[model samples]
Target: MPTHSVLIRDQALVTRLLQQYLHLLKTYPIITKSVTSAVLSALGNLLSQVLESKKKRKDGQSGKEVDVYGPLRFAVYGLVITGPLSHHFYHLLELLFPASAPFSLLKRLLLERLIFAPAFLLLFFAVMNTLEGKTHSDLQDKLKARYWPALKMNWKVWTPFQFININYVPVQYRVLFANLIALFWNAYLTSVRK
Candidate 1:
């Protein structure tokens, strides 16, 4: 009986804490989103490192050790770039194509894929290369090698995801939802980056 009471108290405490956190996130979207993105991107990079290590081991080679700096790089990029950019992009997208009707969702999806996805993917690749100290020629070459394939893959994954996101998720919760999915997306991006 005492244990049951303790469990109940703990559950209630957790619920209250979660509520407070959500309230804070809503009140300060940019800061919260940046922190969330930084954490998730770091985690994603770590996951990628783990997977790569495992693959190397399975291939009968010494596993490559995970480098702390790689994930740190992703965390910084997420904090400074992706978090704020994605938050504002979603807000503007919603304003331009308010999902008031059924087809409006499709419209937003089309606009996002047709316009935003290509442009953002290009910029993301370019910025990542530049930050990694790639010269202009190297950046252009990397983009040529990776951009279209990554964009194609992005369309494959994000098209349906955005359909649900734009139509179903509330405005305030949209970025949070996307950030949750982005854990896996970022992991994939890290692998692709290599």
Candidate 2:
């Protein structure tokens, strides 16, 4: 990377390095999408703050750069939430459900709605909040008071938010379905809460 060398000399290189890592993880599909999002959140949160990365911050640059805290925090979410949830949903869909045409359709629908969708979003918010330096209480409240309500009231807007959510949900049809769900949830939340 052209920026890699330029970043090395600068003490302010922390943010750009993590940004590279975030982009790299998102570039792959086999990896859990939640993990990628969590890393991006970590980079965003870390970039906003000024903290020396591992060895780089302490000993100046010796051509070896290390992320100190940001990646660690992101990993916490990946391990605890992203990996486990994906596996659980995978088993639920592939193993537990019948694989017939109508049953597959219904099973897929149910897996997403009753199992994966809400769990994914909830973990996403939590990971994002952790990565973005938000407190647990703040994240909890936002989930209850802000995010759900935002989804409900401005479901139209929320649905549109899914267009840019391509990185997280790359299966085009699934992305479309998730967007529609978001729109409905947003509208529903608004009506009930506001």
Candidate 3:
């Protein structure tokens, strides 16, 4: 029942949208990751705030500060650090261990889980502590207190996710996929660190 001109106009709109997306994918891959990371990080922090508020309320505490700074720090970290590092690391991972051969998925998964995850956890705590304006000893103490528990929790969540990520996701979409997963993961991370 749609007229010819209306159909053409709809098709043209879709084409334009696709073209813009492809252009971003081709030309601004890292920037796209930064934006995605920032948005998801903010979402995660929002969840963290809500969960913390609920916990406080349950404990008979009131007037908990809804710290906007936490989300802002998350956004900055995502924009400046995690986004670009993940974008490049996944590329290098694919380059070093192309996913075309037998057991490639297993190999990538193991390498990522074993090597990158632990290192990244340490870096994340260090960076977050620094962002909080904690001194070196304070940062070290925080790490000592929280690191292993967080790592254990990270493994609990990320193990299966990375299996799907390294095996099934295309290279171009891998960071976006990870960011999508990270919204929840970051919420978990934020809450755990508290």
Best by the lDDT measure: 3
Per-residue alpha-carbon lDDT of candidate 1 for residues 1-194, written as tens digits (9 for 90 to 100): 47988999999999999898798787998988888888988898898899989999999989988889878887887898878988888888778877675678778888889998899888777777867878999878878888788899999998888888877888777777887787888889888877
Candidate 3 Cα misplacement greater than 4 A, ranges: 1-22
State the displacement of the C-alpha of residue 3, model 2, in Å, after optimal TM-score superposition.
Answer: 22
TM-scores of all models? 0.90, 0.38, 0.86
Q: What is the lDDT of residue 41 in candidate 2?
A: 39
Question: Candidate 1 — what's its lDDT?
Answer: 0.84
The TM-score that candidate 3 achieves is 0.86
lDDT of 2 by residue, 37-72 (tens): 345434543433333334355677543343456445
Clashes of each: 0, 3, 0
The worst-scoring run of ten residues by lDDT in candidate 3 lies at 96-105
Predicted candidate 3 versus true structure: per-residue lDDT over 42-101, tens digit per residue = 888888788888998999999478889988988988888888988998998888888776
RMSD of each candidate?
2.4, 13.1, 4.2
Best by TM-score: 1
Candidate 2 Cα misplacement greater than 4 A, ranges: 1-72, 124-140, 149-194
What's the distance in Å from true for residue 74, model 1? 1.2
Stretches of candidate 1 exceeding 4 Å from the true structure: 1-10
Compared with the true structure, all predictions reach lDDT values of 0.84, 0.48, 0.86
